[model samples]
Target: MSISAPDVTPDVTPNAPWWRSAVLYQIYPRSFQDSDGDGIGDLNGIAARLDYLVDLGVDAIWISPIFPSPMADFGYDVEDYCGIDPRFGTLADFDALLAAAHARGLKILLDFVPNHSSDQHPWFRESRASRTNPKRDWYLWRDAAPDGGVPNNWISDFGGPAWEWDEATGQYYYHAFLKEQPDLNWRNPDVRAAMLDVLRFWFARGVDGFRIDVLWHMVKHADFPDNPLNPAWHVSMGEMHRVLQRHSTDQPEVHAIAGDMRRIADDYSTPGEERVLIGEIYLPLERLMHYYGQDESGVHLPFNFQLIDARWDARTLAQMIADYEAALPPGGWPNWVLGNHDRPRSATKRGAEQARVAAMLLLTLRGTPTLYYGDELGLEDAVIPPDRVQDPRELREPGLGLGRDPVRAPMPWDAGAHAGFSTAEPWLPLGADWRTRNVAAERDDPASMLSLHRALLALRRRHPALGVGQFRLIEAEGDVLAYERVCGDDRIVVALNLGATPHPVILPPGAWRLLLSTTPDPFTDTLAPNQGVILQPER
Candidate 1:
């Protein structure tokens, strides 16, 4: 089914500074909508869904990369930073999408991939032409070992050696991801200038901000030292589990570049407007806070991944929350993310019944919250058949189960053929239970998960404490997590039952008033299993 196009007239007035207190919806462009009957979603398809997104009460949309790529790692392996891939759409389609989104008060933030580029990129192509090319320094290249082996112990995110020997240059080029995606050499001044220009190109087009992809891997050690083998190999996530990643990625110099990027955002922001720059960093709390830099000048939001690491236990979650808040810089803005294109959906991670509870916790947290696509309807991960797997990581490391295809399934729009994603067969199949859990079916039922998401988002907007407030942990016992958000005159106490048993918490008499509850049961008496409650001081 084709996505119906919306009116694309441009808006003259400045949009509301809605991103400050608004929810940002993340769209995996390829799975969001299909307008050309090509089985894959395109820019026009996103334009068609702007109304739906606005109706869902999101103030901004963060689209995954649609840049020109070889699809080695989907659009993450960008060949041209300024151009859109034909699989997605042309430049005109993107302009139309931005116009349509702005008309509906929706700000747009495109994904910025500075860590690496496709081997087919012009820069990389020229860099690999010969050892003496002027652009040879644009990409990371190292000499092979004396035995004609890989340079170091570093492992590709997709498994095996991170360095691939280039016969043409008689040297090894580094690829933190698939071999087709070579890591850029940030040490080169010219490379940094070119990437900054790419940022300016999008900013000139009136983009609100950028979701910097793999922002931590932009720089590497100059000596190219070998990474020590990690003894705990099976504990890591994704393709990283295949081998130890010691010397290759996540170098300290990345912060200097991040600070420069922040300066660029500050330069672009108008007096009263905020131009956001968020980093995709997966690290411990102590290390994550450093990405914000010394004076809260670098990376407006470093993306707190505590929720991704915490289990369903109440005490464990409480500690994680406390640790993150404690480590945040004085004026640094905190951001919460429950799921993304790479990880498993929260619905599947936490059971179906607990998804709403998790959502309440996310929206009520004292920071910006990002919701992944299809998460509003509590969509779980789809089981990808082995024969149909397209992830290069899965193909390279069969035993490790490294692919992310299960979590990146097509979004379920309706209970139609291919879940109404496209008239033609989709690149990936829709979830099997799409008929029961979909936007169309949920829109018609007020009790559905989608409706709950809308109501909660609206509620979050109504309460100032949920957006910009001081978070204080409330005293609670086993299986119950409770916290109070206070902003000036507004004070809200949120309690969540992380387990499957009914839990009870003592509250001051007439001091608690039910504001929102994930479970259908009333919040006055006893909290049900897998329930969440937002309580305001009695009126």
Candidate 2:
């Protein structure tokens, strides 16, 4: 049965799309929960945890790639887009998981990798079989320079030349990420049709939507020119940042791809069962809006990652939020993300105290919000032993701390061995404090981070103003950042003290009731240090 949006958010129409007011939870499958004692998570593991997510109040779950892959860039290198990897599970297992999720009012979003595929993929194999092969145009390939050097100065995100020599074909192929993950030539009509059909396959399987990986990198310059050097580049930055990527990414042609994707997704939509398309883009807010497409026909949400990289302070965040709101095209819905598989955990970046504050902000802000798995427990970056580091980026760029292993630690379920995540040693390490910070410890504690997240989510469900309403920035100065969410006659205010010192909050003229707070302090004219509160004007 379709989830009744009206049953959750008051005054919401049954016809209204669920995604606009939904809170999405992201599950890094390799780390969420492991079954079969294999020390790696799988589809069944996620199905077993459905009740937990439903209880936590997330409307949907956006899982990272589970398609068959070489695991070179970990699942980003798709070997078979239609089949499920045995490491994760089979197609039947995925079907069962989808049914279980929908039965409990949850939607599932798959990760789509349209820009590239593993070199092992049959398509790539056939394309590289011979230069005269019918599929040679399926991927980006060019002849070596007059000096037999690389075709261009393009650099891979994983470092070194983006072009790799294919001895079999006597040509250089481009890979924006890893050599094993060759870029697909989107310019090829056949490539577009095949990828679009991939979406059709899953949509037919009841997949709710997709979070397209590297949406901006789907198309590159036609001439394959050298990317300009970044004047601000420094040794501290990743080697990819050495170039400005002016001609390599966010190309104008990519917007059309996004539109094509949106049209395919729309074909799968119903009144309340609308499918969503979320693009994983990392660009300036102005340029990012283009993914929304002309007249909002593009991706439903372009993924606002501003919060992930923003300075966790009043002034900086305030300006960013304002700028983002201003930059959004008319009728475009905004979203917020603080942490994900690729970035550091919020607790690791802002400390435990401020992580709670960040949570309050994420939940109370306007538009859709995606919560990373384990964030509700305030999970920090787990300490990875040198031998346990499995991220390819970390292996390639040793000692740079660019590895994502730390943030991708296994979810701490309880105090048992491996923090109850698996029966055997997990693929990655659990946080050292897992014993006390696990879900079993925090589930019943009102003051625990998990409980706080639960309360905020429950609050959003009860108040449309908090979930999908107009936002107005009230004050952003010193240590306090305040905003208001309004819908019809319902009005609520959120205030955060981003510093270690107590900050006085001058509520807008009206009697107000404290709905929730990060700190245990009773409602007063002042907020405790590192505290955040949701308030409503008393009638």
Candidate 3:
């Protein structure tokens, strides 16, 4: 049964698309909450916490994959596209969560893994039945090279070659990530038609949008070719960086595929409804902009992760901001993300103080910002001992330190035996400071990270200048970066000192009042070391 449209009009930009300035919060389910004491999170657990999410002030929630899987690469290796994983919940549970979320005026976006599927999927099972099976062309399968070696020089993102030999068949199948995950043959029209129906299944179920994972990897060079060796490749870096992946990713054909996917999503729209499709692409800004498609026919938003890959200092960051803004297509809307399940927590990358400053920069920027779970509480990466590590990346490459276990730890809700996340031991251990760092401890503390986030969110809610205004760079030297956001008469100036020592902000002569600051009460012009502040009416 379909869910009713949200009764309350969402708190969104008056005349603009809802996603333009929406604050999206990502929930990694297993670590979010576990209601059954089974040491894993489920949909019911998420539904239980809907009120908390509302209070946190997010406009939408983007949950990671909850589809049925064999737990090989966690939920990324999906076995069923239309069913919920037994560990996560059943069909009814998801329907309940969707209705409850919409009732709270929060839009929900599901993670769509398009690049590959678990070897156990019904499609893959049927495709591998025989070389001449009716569905044999559903997946990418090629005969062994002339010398009987793996098909090509393609390397898996998880290390080793990208193909796995099948004993029952006289061929090797391609896999971009895990051998258990075989890439789909997207070039096949039948395959494309089948995948389009998958989008329809969820869209008809009332999902507000989809966050397509590995969007660039969906289409690859038709004739398999060796990826060029990276000039900057070093022995110390992850194996994925060893090749440039020129032929393996970001192919020209992908734009058309994206356009088709966007059209399917648009089909579900009603008179006043807009169903968004956000692609999780990590290509360069120049290549990234093309996903928008000609005539606004592609993805609604291709996630911009430049911030995740850039240096933490002001000079490098400022230039990246300018370049990103300049590179957007005429009608392309922008988005930003400070951290996600794939990367280290911002607090761990740049110390706690700077993390607070980053929060300010992310929330006050001109575009939409996606906040990963637990970052709002200033949670640092949990230390995962080698014996307790759960990430496949870390297990596959131990010495390279590619483990994502640290960042995927369970959320700490309060001071409890399991940090109030689960009654049983969590799948991944909780961070060490949960007793003091949990939500309960920080909600009332004026100087805590949680309080700071609430203040910033409150300010953004009240002032369109900070959330959806026009951004203009202000000339500032040294480690300080300054910019102005203006929405008619409601203009605000923001300055940040990325260094460890206090920096004098060179502002035009005027009475600039501090609207919000990382510092304690009684703000001033001299931004304390690693601090960010919001001011009004630039002279």
Candidate 4:
């Protein structure tokens, strides 16, 4: 029989920040929902879906970059940091969206691309105009090598050399990602001040927070030394993996920069207006802890992506979670992510059954969980035809399956024309099975993946133990992984069978009642294959 979420409300502390136990939903603006029939999602489109997000039970939404850009790297390359892209909408439209979201008690987070700006940005245009220009030092520029080749051996994240030659200026500029995107010189005091002002601009406009793009890549070694070659690098890896990036990323000075951003966020924090700072960092857990800053003044939440790349097995995931929990600095809150615009979706990486188990693990874990859009409907990677591929990464490196276009497909609202995303043709293709997998189709199905997510999120909100309680690993062996979350008198035991075989549930001596289960079967001593459940002590 199908199980439903119990009617309960969790006790929340009055002064505590909402992000500590909140569920953040990531929205790719171009793909979420299109309002103007332009085949691209705009601010109005997102505003229209605010109720949908509210119904889904997410506390906040983290939208990818929506700033004015040339679309060379989608929205990551910002041309105007302070203005919204025309494709999305005007500033008034954004204000309306923010106000609407806040009205529903939902927070808003915009992607902050501080590491690099579009080549068309006025700052970069002036900096590239002449070497002696006042803004020349605003971006990284260097003279060519003796042989007139590239400046250094640095490689772009897309592929090939990271440096691009400027024929007019006769110098090279650095870009960590695309040649059309120039890296900003954060070492310059004026550049830092300007980027910090960008944060203040949003906070002043009532934006809740920011999800910083490439936070660790902002600071580079002062000497600009060549990165060492990676011995473990293989041909199968991306070209950027050839070098260890020892001097190019994760520099010592980055912490100071993070601290500066944190101070700005704090400046705007009042009793009810608590601004959060989330850094998108992909580093080892040990090094990732430093982003929290000294005295806990750094980024509020450094996005944890270990689950995205971790092995989808019982023991491996359990150990990884423990290690991450142990590595957080004092007073540092934790967050988790299953997928984003850059990586494959959880359902695509693991099968549909395992994805349900993953959803249980994500919401029940002792941290804020960020859910990628479309994963709730159990959407898989869209099949992009060769002619229809839009991702520059895949276009640059074909056949490697590195293209993110598949995961960035349009959100299927219904089975109508273009899956009800837009009247016009979408910029990207929709999934093949949108007819049955769309949100409209699964909204009422009690056993659908969408329903499972709603139930899990409802359960998380109803229990203090699952929200901000202590986490203790009860068992992690073979196909089963069990953990207990205890908050004073409220205690929850989360058990999962990650493998495709039944595993006996091993709980403490106390009698337990099954609160929810991924499978339709009733509570039993054994957990069915690819099943997960939440239990509480029988008082």
Q: Which stretches of candidate 3 lie over 4 Å from their true place?
A: 1-14
lDDT of 3 by residue, 68-118 (tens): 999899999999999999999899999999999999999999999988999
Superposed by TM-score, candidate 4 places the C-alpha of residue 291 at a distance from the truth, in angstroms, of 0.5
> Over 4 Å off in model 1, which ranges?
1-18, 235-239, 242-244
Clashing pairs in 2: none
lDDT of each: 0.83, 0.90, 0.87, 0.90
RMSD of 4: 3.9
- In model 1, pairs of residues that clash are 1-422, 1-423
223 Cα displacement, candidate 4 (Å): 1.2
Q: How close is candidate 1 to the true structure, as a TM-score?
A: 0.94
Models 1 onward score TM values of 0.94, 0.97, 0.96, 0.97
Clash totals for all models, in order? 2, 0, 0, 0
Q: For candidate 2, lDDT tens digit of each residue in 419-510?
A: 98999999988889999999999999999999999999999999989877778787546888888888878899999999999888777888
Predicted candidate 1 versus true structure: per-residue lDDT over 1-539, tens digit per residue: 11111111211124523455668899999899888898899898889888889888888999999999989888999999999999999999999999899889888999999999999999998998998999999998989898989887788877777889998789999988889999999999999999988888988888889999988878888898877766665544544654444456678888899988888887788844568898998776787888998886688888877797578888888877776776667666668899998888899888888889999998988778999999999999888888878777678877554567877888888988888888888888778799889999999788888988998888877877776666777667888888877767887888999989888876544667887789888776567999999898887
RMSD in angstroms, all models?
6.8, 4.4, 5.7, 3.9
The Cα error of candidate 2 at residue 395, in Å, is 0.9
| TM-score computed on alpha carbons, candidate 2 | 0.97
